[model samples]
Target: MLTKMGKKGSSCIIFSIMLISSFFSISISSEQMIDDYRGFSDSNNSFANFTSAGSSTVAISGEPAHVGDEMIASILVSNVGSNNGVANLIIENLEDGISHSGSPVEISPGSSREVKAPITSQEQGSVSYRWWISSNGSHVNASLSGEFSVEVLPRQTISTYLESYDWSPSEGLVLDASLFLSSGASRPLLLDIFISKDDGPLNHLQEYTIEMDPGRRNLQIFLGNPSADSVFVELSPIEWSPNPTSLNYSTLTVNSPSADPSLLDIECTVSSLEPTSGESVRMKVNLTNNDNFQSPSGKLRIVLSSDQSILAESVIPPINPGVSVSYEMVIQSWPDSEIVQLEIIWSSEESSSSVFLSVQSSVRDDGFALPFDISSALLGALSGIVIVLTGRLVWRATSSRTPSTSESGIRKTRIEREEHSANVQTREIDCPFCEQRLSIPAEHDGNARCPSCSMQFNVAKMGETTSSIDEKPEAIENEIPMSFSTDDILECPGCDQTLRVPIEKRPVQSRCPVCKLEFLAEKG
Candidate 1:
């Protein structure tokens, strides 16, 4: 709809085209009298309030043609009565059998009802539709008609292929699912859905078990809640409902390193933030591990205490091995002196040597004070902040408060003494590896060599009981076994059981009682 000024511009151009071609005059008629069609109805007296002053007849620009012909029509109805009134929509639609799809307005007295309607030709060629309006005004306003030509053609056939599936609300949302539809084609198709925790059909496409529409193919399949890049949706002829292909690749990253919130290791940084009384404060503690062997499980225990009692304690779970994890521990100010300590421990696991444990003191005390105004009126406003900062640590009397040291489960330290000169001097010269050391001293002056270490040492004669300063008292005597008489003789290594062993040969290697097994025990 052009404005009045815009219409004037086009009117000037039309006027120039008309003037250049020939001579003509375009003028507005103000003095001429005009009277619309006036005809008396057969039952005009039946309506006592039948008073109308607007035109009833209308002409749509793109109507009066075969079926399926689209038309844009307008209503030009006018009021014919002197009294001001509106034209009802029920009268307009019912009189012409026209179903309106949009807003219909009221037609006032001495005015018009201009409507734009889309006429679609959905019938055979050369068909006509007669449309009109009923009114008590003049015959010309109530009865109006026009016609047009339409050449019909065959309808176009289109197939709606299930190109792919589209997922909305993205990821990390808690919605069930959405609506999917495939229109146009009459044939039926199937649709399938797949969800992968990682990526690329790691979790394959599983068919939907819920009841669905086969003809409408209107898919309302829902997944619980998507937590990935996107779910692969396929709709192909292989299935019935959603024969869709995965249009977009929705990658999934779950159970990855980024999934966990904290970790455990030898040196760890733990952090926390809390309000002591009001003001929030944060704390970070670095912990180390000292153990006999490596551990499989990475668990850390943190105990937080105050001047009089324990505040917070956390048992952290396993962390990646051989790595440092940072934990943020919030240090809440109780508005007093608080003690915080961290204990890091790891348990032994397969393939690892042994577990280790370590504890460290991070926060010894809280020394914060909140400033306040000097007025009592502002006390309430700063009460929370003051207590967290000042009242928490408000000292009653300055006492030499000792630093706290927690009792641990560590083993006692063993004392290590220096080597003494006595054991070094008394160290045995005889070698025990080759059984060269004797219980009874023997005259090992010659033909005596230590089979072990290939060392030789002198000895006294006649198998003595005592020795010199470097010799043992009875090294050979104790080593030699006792002998027996003829009747009590044991078999000897040189003779049979017939040989008699005498008491004088008491220091000797042992001989078998039945056969001579001349071993170390029989020699004297």
Candidate 2:
């Protein structure tokens, strides 16, 4: 009976151990399954918030595409809620069969990008369209849909015809032409105009590519010279709409140049002083013909340009001889320029020439401080007289305090003191151009010349003072003296390198040897 009890106890212990292990395994598996389910549930809830952040718009570029012509139907998307999602676009509801010429595009959150869908018209007619743009990510999914329409118009017809053609030795070859277009919108048209002399084989003279809008366009083209007695001109179209014509041709006789040798004599003049930089100013110019006899017709080409590039140009009508014509042109200067110039180019069939005019900065004009103003000059003179009187009084007081010397000695002493006082009264001034220091006579007039840079400037209008060169004069009303010094120096504003330049070179344009930058310098 004891042996049987031992066997039963061992069997019960083994069964109890297995039951405990099965309980632990079931608890761990249940916990892991619950965690996975919660994760999937969280992902589904996050996707519910995913959506487009802004309005979507669809449009067609290069519209009115002709039959069999390919164009783009583009969709603009913006502001997604997630980062890096793939967008699949579906375009439907079109009779011409618009295809999705693009694949699903991957985009970033809160950014805009264009998705192009190329489309072509199978036949000419109006068609409606629908677009469904959808995107999906690992954690979210969303979509947007819209519709639009496109119009397919038929191709337009164009025809070429010559209105009039003529040639002259002086005026070149002139052709008056027109093009006819039937229906449709405006487009670019290329024309090849051919010219022949005395009914020989046609030779290409010029090719004009112009935008041919609906209606009759009258064109005037001029070629410099056609060395022919009898000339024939023909108009042919190239790579253009519709078809070209074969019967657009004209004939004309050649004319000779004017016999008067002086008929082309011309003169041009500007009407205003140099303008301020960045100042939009009107420059009026007068062109006069000096020819006394023949009234010749001529073409005028006027151009207003800068040192860098041409700013503006225009073609003016013919000017008759012995008549003066006035033309007003508007131009602007560089905003940062202290000084700018306009290079005006005038050309005609007779001759061509160019001229330049300088424009100064307004800052330069506003900073000028004139030492020779009438009031300032009067003040300086008054100060000099008072100093002379004061010096005499002081001398008298000193002489009375001490024992009196001989009469000749006293007279000599007084004269020496007066001379010393006058010398002390002289003021030092800076050149206006190179900022070179100079010493002027005590009784200086309004005009002075720089010894370092020979820049002659009127003290009445060109005097300027800066903090770096302010001088204190004992008896002079002006802080700056009115003279120039031969030993003055100039400092390059660009590189700060001091240069010893000649006095006569003052108020000149200088190129710094170190930096190679040009600057305007003045004698101080």
Candidate 3:
């Protein structure tokens, strides 16, 4: 009975201890739960007054950007609530190898701020991208997004070279070239062609604006004569758009042959060495080419050396090797008796040669001399006729004279002689051959001789009535009248001498007495 009572007491004490421990644990758990609730309530109360009012914006700023160039993007954030804001800009979905980013920016209340970022692309094409703006502030937490594109232009390339070149005396210099271009945009490009001689300064030869489609094109340029032995040609670009990656300049060197003197032979001869005044002098100029293979052409100039005046100018045709050509030139002789100096000049593209010659002129005379025998015979004949006529007149006078006893008888004999001389009336007639006037007795009609030309012709009796000295004469008795039609008179063409012909013959072949030229005479 005592052992059972002890065990029961121990059991009762253990129960009491367990109940006390349980009560303390319950109190500690309650305190921990209260602390957690208080912390949750405090966090909820802190954010209870936050409000989102304004918004954020994003955009792409730079468009139509070229390849390898930087593009700009912008982000704008506005804060209209009762708190400040912070904005961040980021570019997304850009082309490969292209990127852009910006740092966060802070904005005050009731204000806005912008953020910008630069993006670079390596290739040419349309670059599509997305822009994002993240705004964080005491009253707002929002994100803005948009899509945009940037057009990237392609780079340009240009190259040029000379294909051929030529030079000539007539055409100067000619150049042929090829131009190549590769571009993705249309723009004006300046092309400059330059030339240099013997390492001299570059001279601008030609300038052209390239505005055609991208391809290969041919160009023909005429640079004229530079007058240089060695020339250098260069082609380069002056102005261009979308700056080219490869703009190669081309150059060429040209060499020319050495200059040579003229190789020509000339010979000249004149028609008369001593020409008279009012005479035409003919000169024959013969040119011979001495060159073995060269064919040359130029001008021939004739100048009077005394006054340095040009007489005649003619073009010299192209003469082949070992060829010859002749030219004839006529000039009037000077009026004075002087020496005429002439200069013949032969000029070519490279050289010139001249020859000097002279001519003499003199005055002309009008008188001519006959042979000695003919002059002597004429003088002797004239003297014999004069002596015979004088002797006859003296004999007749002596035989017919009566012995005069007084001075009155002598006077009567002289008056009878004068009356006998007055009965022989004379008339004037023209010689047909020499047109010289001759006096003959009015009653005489027979063959007569012209004293001037020694030409003999027949004279017919004139039917005219004699008038006494007291009566007034209707016509002069000393002059002979000759009336003929124009058809009866003809002029010799060779010597231009006048001849009287019969009217009965319409056309007659006759010989001129002066020049002895036989020709047909006709009436007009």
Query: What TM-score against the true fold does each predicted structure earn?
Result: 0.23, 0.37, 0.29
The weakest ten consecutive residues by lDDT in model 1 span: 397-406
Clashes (backbone N, CA, C under 3 Å), per candidate, total 79, 21, 0
- lDDT of candidate 1 vs native? 0.37
For residues 336-377, write the lDDT of model 3, one tens digit per residue: 346777788777665666788777766565477555686488
What's the lDDT for candidate 3? Answer: 0.62
Q: Among all windows of ten consecutive residues in candidate 2, which has the lowest summed lDDT?
A: 472-481
Residue 121, model 2, lDDT? 61
Q: Model 1 Cα RMSD, Å?
A: 36.3
**Candidate 1 local lDDT, 156-181, one digit each (tens):** 22122222343332332222333233
The local distance difference test score of each candidate is 0.37, 0.56, 0.62
Q: Sort all candidates by TM-score, best to worst.
A: 2, 3, 1
Which residue runs of candidate 3 sit more than 4 Å off their true CA positions? Answer: 1-156, 165-174, 220-247, 252-524
lDDT of 2 by residue, 17-111 (tens): 89999999999999999999999877654432223434555667876566555567666565444445565556775664655645766666666
Superior candidate under TM-score, 1 versus 3:
3
